[model samples]
Target: MLISDSQKKILSLLADGEFHSGAELAEVLGVSRSAVWKQLNGLESLGVPHAAVSGKGYRLSRPIELLDGAKILDHLDEQHRAKISSLEIHDQIDSTNTYLSSLARQNAPSGSVCLAERQTAGKGRRGRQWISPYGSNILLSILWRFQHGPAAISALSLAIGVAVIRALRRLGIDKAGLKWPNDIYSEGKKLGGILIEVAGENEGPCYAVTGLGLNLFLPEEEAGAIDQPWTDLGRIAGGRPIGRNQLAGELIDQLLKVLTGFEQTGLAAYLDEWREYDCLCGESASVFIGAQQFDGTLEGIDAQGFLLMRDADDRLRAFASGEVSFRRAFP
Candidate 1:
């Protein structure tokens, strides 16, 4: 559903979790009381929780920290802020990755970043839908150009995963860890995910769009479609308040730093950190590549970022790309 500017204004007005009467809302929105009522009702279609009372006006079920480009930029230092070529904050979109990819094709600068408060068709790993409700979580994508070829940056996604951990660590969240290939986990539950799309010459320059979808205040109503056990930063932080804008800025800073230097350092600089947060080092998980599935003990990734595993026959093998699914402990 496309959220109109008036709907966005209404959401902003009620984002404080405090009620605003019809007359008050109408006055601020410069619309009639009935138009204000219509806008409020439209929020329900976007899965924005709101309530109204006879005595009071309307308020969201909870306060939402909407994406603000200025606030995010404020959290960054002058160096990093200057490095960003452009920052776009969308009220809603299909997918930030797709959005930036188009811009990249149009010769968008390397440090261009895209953030959305909600994604109607968010992309996920292995062709899955990334379910994110309006004003519920962080949806970020960064566009960066690389001097190295695809092979040289084979482990780029894992390196980005390490950057994600660093950003979370900056928030005093030490519970976060990596579930290899490209997932962020905390307390054995999925916390976030990463997707990197690259396009360029075979051995020349390339540009990659790195997308991150992290859970913050995920409502149960919008999470029913998710198949795996999941936890948001709210739960991982032990119900403590997290500064969404600050977190966004931190993520951009860390991820861009990695992207900028990735060509010179490759993955060597990031390999150790990735190993430190490797959650499935010795876990027996199911790895799927297309129609085939391999059940084995994950032995961590190799220097080139290939996933290493020991299969049932005690044979060691490496996979360049696939889906990793955590299996339950044997009985």
Candidate 2:
């Protein structure tokens, strides 16, 4: 659901995590006290928790760092700023990737980007749901047109994983690593994921909408929907302050750098870094493609970013696409 002006105003005020009286909130929003109460009551729908003290009125359950375009751009290198043709931030949207893909169809420039605080219809690989509590994670997508089409960037998603880990390391969160084909793992739990959608002629010009959903602070309420082990920076930072804006900025910078060089070099430019951060290079895992499952020991990724698994029969097999689950968590 798109946020209304009044809702934005109230949220901005309450974002300080300080209680404000109902009268003060109502006066600031030019609405009645009853209206303020209704809006506060509505926060739960957005997955935003709040506390309503008997005398203190209301405040968010915890402090939050809302996405700010200026703060994010301040983290971008000046030389790379020009590379971003269009940029936007939405208070709410169905999906950043879906929105950016629409712009790509309209001939949007190569560096167009779209981000949202919440995704009502976020997507994930193999038709799964990617969920994020409002303003609690990074939901972003970038559109880049490739001259050589799909094959040119066969390992693009893997390259994106490298970029993500690089950003995390820069922010002093060095343990985050990559799970082949696309998930981000740290200490055996998922921290985020990458999903790339490319379209156009197989051999001609095409465009890709590279989407990233990262958990900075996945509230317990939001975590209930997830079926597997997952984590967030709130846990990884280990009491160190987690800065949302800083990480988003670093991701944009690293992604642009990777994209700027990828067409000329493909995954070759990122292979070394990707390997350095590989989380399942030699792990036991299960690969599921439809009803069939293959039990194997992972042997890392190939040059094109495909999964290389040693089947139970001891024969090495490369899989282009499938869902993989580690036989056991590894730290």
Candidate 3:
């Protein structure tokens, strides 16, 4: 069930483990006592049962076992973890990236994460619609600010792909592979995608919002909305529902570790690691760059992260940016 900002506020207040009188909550939230009662009852209906004492008011019967922001913070070392200034979770949103971008404009600190259980209008690279069902997929965005130029920021997506693949491997999804700039694949099917947006001057300090949408378990009814073959972590992990909050925390930690290095050396520093997990390399593929299309065998990415290909005439060509589709070529 979706929880509103007001409900979240009430939950936060009750999270202290002390009985907060209904009048006190109403005063704090600027609502009537009756309204508070209604909200509390709504929460109870949503499986968050609470106890109401005649004089003391309402208290959660049990602490919310949801993701622990403090615990995640405690697990990280001082340096990398300290980058995060805030972590906000939403029950529903249009898009995590969109929400984070709005916060970035207001100068929200870097490493701020805005996550949602579902996104009504999630999107991927080139404005492709992302499938986001409630409680079944991860829809999150991390706000990062860099002092580098836009040219340097271009490789950030690729760098983040490496981080996602590493995190998935940690969860025992070993066959995960990255498809070009930002798609994560398993068994030749897409498992997740990364979308990045930047705001600021071309060369000055820039804020990049990196959004991640990962399928944990796809609802059967909603699975048809996905255009291509796709798989979820639940299937790969033997029907275990990965704790979304835990996965988010781990992904953020690893991403910060990687992005710090990337900001210094660009994609060149991670070339070998990227190649070790390359999914399209050594396969025949089609590169769509504007109106011109080329069919070639995937060689490998160059030092600067450009896709390298060998054409039918055995001629070599390098593509920097385009839509690439992989397939097995018939001899």
Candidate 4:
């Protein structure tokens, strides 16, 4: 659901985690007190939790860092800045990937980016919903046109993972690791994920919408909605406040380099770098495909980005895609 401009304004005011009276919000926004009350109430539908006391007024459940387009653009290196055609910031959207994919079909220029403050229908790999709360995470997508077909860019997700880890490390969060095809983990808990969608023909030119979601902070109410173990930058940073705009800028800069170089080098250029952040390498894990499951020892990724698994019989097998569960080494 799209939010009103007033709602967006109120959110920005409340982002610092300070309480504000309805009268104060109205005075600041040039709206009536009743209008401010209604807007605050509407935020609940958008998954934003807040507290309203008899005397203290309203405040968000937690402090948040909202993305700023100007800050992100200002942080980009000259070369990276040149690669972008346009950058859009939205208060609410169904999904950044969905928005970009549609634009790609309409011949949107390469290097176009879309960032949303909240995603009502964010997506995850294998058809799972990507839970995102207002102003609490990085929800972004970049559309890049490639000369090669889908097959040529199959390992793109793996390469994107490398970029994400590089960005994290740049910010001093060194514990994050790559989880095979498309996840970022810290101490076995998910910190973020990527979802890539391709468009165009089979033989020649194609376009990719690389979507990313990184958690900055997860409120208690939002945490309960996730099924798997998860950790945000807040926990990773040991309660230190992270700058959402700065992080978003770093992600865009690193990913632009990855996407631009990927066409010429494929995943080969990133293999060694990716290995450094391998999360499941040298571990025991289970792979799930459909209703079938196989237990194997994780042996890291192959040159082509396929997962290499050593089974009980000491035979090596490669898989291109599967749901993986890391566990204790098999006996």
Question: Each prediction's Cα lDDT score?
Answer: 0.89, 0.88, 0.79, 0.90
Off by over 4 Å in 3: 1-68, 71-75, 329-331
Model 2 agreement with the true structure over 185-303: per-residue lDDT tens digits: 98899999999999999999999999999999898778898888899988999968877888889999988888888899888878888888998888899999999998889988887
Q: Pick the candidate with the highest lDDT.
A: 4
Q: What RMSD does each model have against the real structure?
A: 1.7, 1.3, 7.0, 2.1
- Lowest summed lDDT across 10 adjacent residues in model 1 is found at 322-331
Candidate 1 lDDT: 0.89
Sorted by lDDT (best first), the order is 4, 1, 2, 3
- Please identify model 4 stretches exceeding 4 Å from their true place: 53-56, 329-331
lDDT of 2 at 157: 91
TM-score of 2: 0.97
Tens digit of per-residue lDDT, candidate 3, span 1-331: 5777788789878865579999999999999999999888877544456799999999986443244567656546688777878888777688889999998999998888787766778988788898855444678788888897677778778888888887777777787888886889887888899998887888788888999998876755667867778888877788665666667767887788876677788887678888888888898899998888999899878887888999999999988789888885322
Better of 1 and 4 by lDDT: 4
lDDT of 4 at 221: 78
Rank order (by TM-score, best first)? 2, 1, 4, 3
TM-score (all chains, Cα) for each model = 0.96, 0.97, 0.78, 0.95
Please give the lDDT score at residue 29 for candidate 1. Answer: 83
